[model samples]
Target: MSPFNNHLEVAGFEKILLLKFSICVLFSVGVWVIYTQKARLSSIPNSKKALFFLLSFIILRILPFLIIYVILDFSARSDVRMFYDSALGALKLGFVYRDFETAYSPIFPYLTALPLLIWDSAKAIVLEMVLVEGIILWFTYKYYKNSLGNYYLLLYLMLPAPFVFSILGGQEDIWMWAFVLWTCFILRKNSNWLLAGLIMGLGLLTTKALLVLYLPALFIFAKKPWQFMLGLLIVGIPSLAFMYYHSELLFLSPIQQANDPRTPNIWSVLHPLTNGFVPIGPKILNWVGLVSIQALGIFFAIKSKKTSKPHYFLVFLFLIISVWLMIIQQSSLSNYAYVFLMPMVFFFGEQTNKKWLILLLLLNLFVVIQPPIWWGIGMPIFHSLSDLNSGYKVLEYITEIGVVVLLFAFLRIIIKNFKTTNNSNV
Candidate 1:
């Protein structure tokens, strides 16, 4: 049985379950309204648009949690329970890597634990997540406001995937992107390379180790590699020293995380055929994926050297990360799609392709609903081949295929842009 199930009250569980279904229904209605009233929404004043988005975000994301945990006094489920466990463990142990094990960065457990210093409840960790999400949303809006307009923000806010993954699952996959977005804002001046590197180094320490995969894009785009490297070393050295002082276990976290079960990915889809065995094995596939991402980053850098546009950079960065998520073993959960939300909005906001937009919306719907269906039926959120059921497996296949198609479409767009840039240069 799941840990949260042990403490769950029947009345609370039923209420929360009903609330989840209601939120999904409301999200569907909101999407329909947005689609039918696009012209009317676009005509609204910027101030009102911002206010509406904020209010809607709070209602959909924040209020439900407040109702469930605060008023209803229910135990949080899914990763939030694990997060609370890690925080409490950190508080008791006093050092994260040394005294305990966590797949997250060294700072993450402590950061999650910070809220407990105030309220001393697991709900505090969820509140901390909300705050982190708010920071991410604010940075995303500020950075993309002029380039993409309010429509992109509207879509991001209204999207069910972001709400489900970030709020309901309490996943922090997008936390790394928050620092990336802030660095994007800083790099707008072109002379802030050092500061950007410093911020990224801090991100490396606090957020997912996957942030390292994004470094190639930053390095390729840097005006002065030496200055950026210097700034990275400034924080990198101290962070490394701190980790070393704590324990050698700190360096093993990534390897440990890599052994986690595969999810909503091609490997998982093919698992039944292989009888839950990979012909090439996961470690080899992981290395191949990493090497492929590095090669793609280099190829994109070469093709787009003359294109210093910020939006193009976002596209390339998204491509690199998307490739990693698509191919890498043990790393392709549907929730990871949240990382693509901001970049997708910024990259495709002006495109008139209804097919791509429709595909994206369908992908979000499948991704959002899959979790609830699986959990509601007592299936594990991240499952092995043996754990699969026909009901949940169908959604998994659809969501994975949709992601693959969407990613290929993005690649086509990037290639087309590259060709346009080259022809214009000639």
Candidate 2:
């Protein structure tokens, strides 16, 4: 690279960061002023105030992710180990119609390709991510506006992890989750079923994380088959399209799956463990892990005195996890960390105290590091299991360690909840 060109890129990227930082800071101050200016939150009881503070504390805890990722991009953005790299390759290598040869739904990578075609720079692409993320933020705040006051909105503002996905890896994980949530809100309002289905379906194609949506959809649409069917239709069409076009090529090719050296899900990490150690298939372990966690949660959930639409959401999450881990591969570290959100939103809404909140926060920290380490941590773990000398070996090891601990942790919580519930019944 020419020194002049290098200098220009550095100068230009710095300018962009300065501009973004300025805008974000100003926007944050405006939001804070609007929040404090009103008497809406002032009238809340002292306890709610405290709960609000703790929740916001958790959100703010990850706020520095933006700065760290912005720097990481300079060095690691081109790293082939990133999931985004594989997704992007499908587009950059001209495999749009033959997405099966690559991994994942082609839409996200195609979008990434679009931005790169114009600017050919990671900074510009991430800026686009920030913009899209900002829009999602606006709608997210809107979704909770009626249910949450300033305290809750503050948590949304500082939601460190989701924001990090946008700022750092240029990941579309948040959008997938956000769209699925939007579909839920729309369904709650009795809005368009086809649109909702399409929204969720597209979310599914983009990231496996949205596979969680299908769990909720199953029960909600169990009796209402049409809605469920419609969602499947919408969600599956794009993926099927890729499959149809690439029928000669392998579907769900091993190479595509092999891209991730570490994943807690059976496809990437579990099967390898069995091959290296036990004769058992990782799929078997996955089903056992998922179903065991699920059955206990659902059985307890149904028996609990509390039965509401929101409670049903928890059941939906339980089902999602059951099927997701058992069936899908490539569920990432952040994906597992996402499980903590369930307890936080659920227990907090139930008026469970700060102690419960703190416990889940600690658990969140634990689970957050599981599988396909997001930022280079799990490489060694992956290497240990896949091939100790390979770059991704450590990723497997950590994934193995993480999964064992998480499996035990998930079971422990379920048993604890069950025993507690039974004792209360007695």
Candidate 3:
């Protein structure tokens, strides 16, 4: 069997039994490590302790996942496999567009292939991801206030959504988030529009969602727009030139992705009423959502002119992301919401108001927590709870609604922040 085939290994009673045994052993070790390290990590001076905890957590979690996944040869996501194939096509097959029906931006094929270059093993790719996540979380801790640094790190690692997505799903969203956070971190210290723009450009190649960051970049470099454009063009021009040779495949992902129907988004509720799984949507609403994204982007860009603080831009960014999640039909996966959690932890962790924090936690748990046999049994047990159901259709709609509620709550917090900031300025 091909290693990349997801259907064969992830199914069957034997595979489930093996996976369960591995998880049980790994969980026990993780608990033991935490218990033993608690005192030792606490004994370190506050200045140095966060890094200690961060690395310890990364290893304790990553080591088990690395071993189990390799032993089982668990399926990497189809998206990853597709990107791998696209990369191979690029490298050995002359990188033709229709060759693999490449749907992603030009740079992604190369980015995904970097791990394959290091080691032919799937574990190596996952390990590289774990390392990159470690760095992102470490800097997140570094930039956040010391008192809440450990809290944020623990929240990130222990969260169910992030955990499953990182280890099992092997989603590439973290790479995009890491680049955006790094860009913002640098901009926080100095006004380097060129570097920030370059980072944004690079990030876009990995995940189109990073296009949202352009709002903050525009505001930060409002006076130096030329520099921002120059930096963007530096990276973007080459990709465009490469795509020119690759032909129409450059536009395929964006076009098809916009209409692709996944679940657990606002569209889930509407899907039954609309065309069934045809990757189409209400044309008018589509236009509206697109306009709203741009309108909010422009608003944030204008509002950011008043304050030079990077937090102002971040606050605006939080709102823009919420709007994007709320409106974008393409964002059907619950994991897409992971983009908001990092910024939330950094800015809201220290806040006295726990409403948004609590809501976000509930949201993460609702989306991430899953029965062990979800894939093995072909569906979660909850679907059978309602006999009136059409194969878990009701449950899917409920999950999507829950996500919508959490998003609106978050939007309220954003509005409150803008009001408070305005009042303080006056």
Of the candidates shown, which would achieve the greatest lDDT relative to the real structure? 1
**Against the true structure, candidate 1 has what lDDT?**
0.65
Ranking by TM-score: 1, 3, 2
Among the numbered candidates, top TM-score falls to 1
TM-score of each: 0.82, 0.58, 0.76
Model 3: per-residue Cα lDDT at residue 116: 77
Q: How many residue pairs clash in each candidate at the backbone level?
A: 0, 21, 0
Cα error, candidate 1, residue 115 (Å):
1.6
Write the residue-wise lDDT of candidate 3 on 1-426 in tens digits. Answer: 432233442345445435534543454344344434444533567867755675766565576576657776666652556656766766565554555556655566665667777776555556656666677777766666444455556655655556666676555666666766777676666868788778878876666644644444364435566777787889888877776766744445555565544445555544444434433345655565567666666676666666645534654565456546554654346666666666665554444244544565567654553222233335322322232144233434565567766766766666566545432111
Question: What is the model-wide C-alpha lDDT for candidate 2?
Answer: 0.45
Q: Rate the local accuracy (lDDT) of all candidates.
A: 0.65, 0.45, 0.57
Q: How much does candidate 3 score in TM-score? A: 0.76
Q: Which stretches of candidate 3 lie over 4 Å from their true place?
A: 1-47, 71-73, 90-93, 96-98, 209-221, 248-252, 270-280, 352-357, 369-388, 418-426
Candidate 2 residue lDDT tens string, 235-332:
68666776667653454453344234344544445445565453233445444544554554455545542443432343344434533443343434
For lDDT, candidate 2 versus 3, the one ahead is 3
- In model 1, the Cα lDDT at residue 316 comes to 51
lDDT of 2 at 58: 41
User: What residue pairs are clashing in model 3?
Assistant: none
Better of 1 and 3 by lDDT: 1
The CA lDDT at 68 in model 1 is 71
Which residue runs does candidate 1 get wrong by more than 4 Å?
1-25, 46-53, 271-281, 310-315, 371-399, 406-426
RMSD of 2: 10.2
